[model samples]
Target: MSDETNNEGLNEAPWRATILTLYPDMFPGPLGTSLAGRALENGLWSLDILHIRDFAEGKHRNVDDTPAGGGAGMVLRPDVVGRAIDAATGEGDMRPRILLSPRGKSLTQEKVRSLKEAGGAILLCGRFEGVDQRVIDGRNLEEISIGDYILSGGELGAMVLMDAVVRLLPGVMGKVASGEDESFESGLLEYPHYTRPTIWEGHEIPEILASGHHGKIAQWRHEQAVALTKERRPDLYEAWEAEE
Candidate 1:
């Protein structure tokens, strides 16, 4: 049996997301498929895909132009991107507006947690060199980066950010605890997970797992997760220390 939108399930909270991109069709096949798709298909969320080119001037539907001052890559026209943003969030109320740029502030779990408000969100996916500076400044949008590296387009970055934040919204996950214990949830890497076999080809399950001491096992996992995070991402460890 499949839950292809049951009437009772429609009663589940459905969040709304509006993505402003030149390539709306790029999405949704597999990229944001995990939690994002389930949220959309089951009516847990509604995704509004807006094509920036649709709002363009001519038959060419141009959305970008060469950057002024002579840059290697073109800069997306400010007016086009800004108009798309406005359409997505609407002029009614203020929402957390995000401009995806490689040079922007690095995305983080805490940042994702901050946008958990039930209000709608608008994501601007820039292409070419980047969106025009005038657009970013004029909109006063918060800039976010998935990592230090650069990608050809902002659509992938937007999807990553959207998936992360949307899952945090209330009622997205079928299981309430799904997002609560994942890696980075507690500023720590996730502890290892085990499944049914108990014993694999060359290894046996950890003895403590079979000890039945639930409290002790839980404490052990937390300590291990913290240690792993400390080893892998020193930045997270430093932030944890600052908080402590």
Candidate 2:
């Protein structure tokens, strides 16, 4: 990530982000690659990193402690984490503050689009068991989870969320419409994709794709998308049907 501060030349920044984590080095990790990296270099967005431990009171820089009630792991202290969040945001900052957690509302393409439209976000990457719930409630943090499984830390989840959102920002992707029909965008999984070498390993590409009939091709893609969604994700298929 850039050494540039979040408030650096505030007027010129198109998109801004601030990550609060115990492991600041993990940032810009994958975001520093491919489209996201290029966007960062082009100033399409700006990232600011904040280390949560910096707010800890003791010499050990202990940001977490044993859970109050009793648990297998530690919980981030509310006061320290709250201070970090306040440092990133001041009065009247409208950017949505997000916390990456397993129990959060599942992240969706619609949510990603909303975040992109906002042009910025403050992401909190929790470690240990989780953050003190008080900070989450007091800071008005929108908790978001990428999937059903768990990760070792929220840094990776934050990166995943950022990558998903950043690619949708203006000029990041080559074609704007390219993302519109992707998985979950239409409440259905995307259709299968095929390339040259029509026949590979004795498996032939779908005939409709090769028919050169634009209308039929479009119909075929829509049908395949529906079938795939219904087979792979019954929940999404049901929602799609309900919408229709």
> How accurate locally is residue 55 in candidate 2, as Cα lDDT from 0 to 100?
92
| Overall lDDT per candidate, in order of appearance | 0.76, 0.87
Cα lDDT of model 1 by residue, 7-45, tens digit: 334575555667788777887745346656766766766
Runs in model 2 deviating more than 4 A are 1-13
Model 2, total clashes: 0
lDDT of 1 at 163: 78
What TM-score, computed on C-alpha atoms, does each candidate reach?
A: 0.88, 0.92
Model 1 backbone overlap count: 0
Task: State which candidate has the highest lDDT.
Answer: 2
Per TM-score, the best of the predicted structures is 2
Looking at candidate 2, the ten consecutive residues that score lowest on lDDT are 1-10
* lDDT tens digits by residue: candidate 2, 62-128: 8989998786999999999999999999788899999999999999888988998887999999888
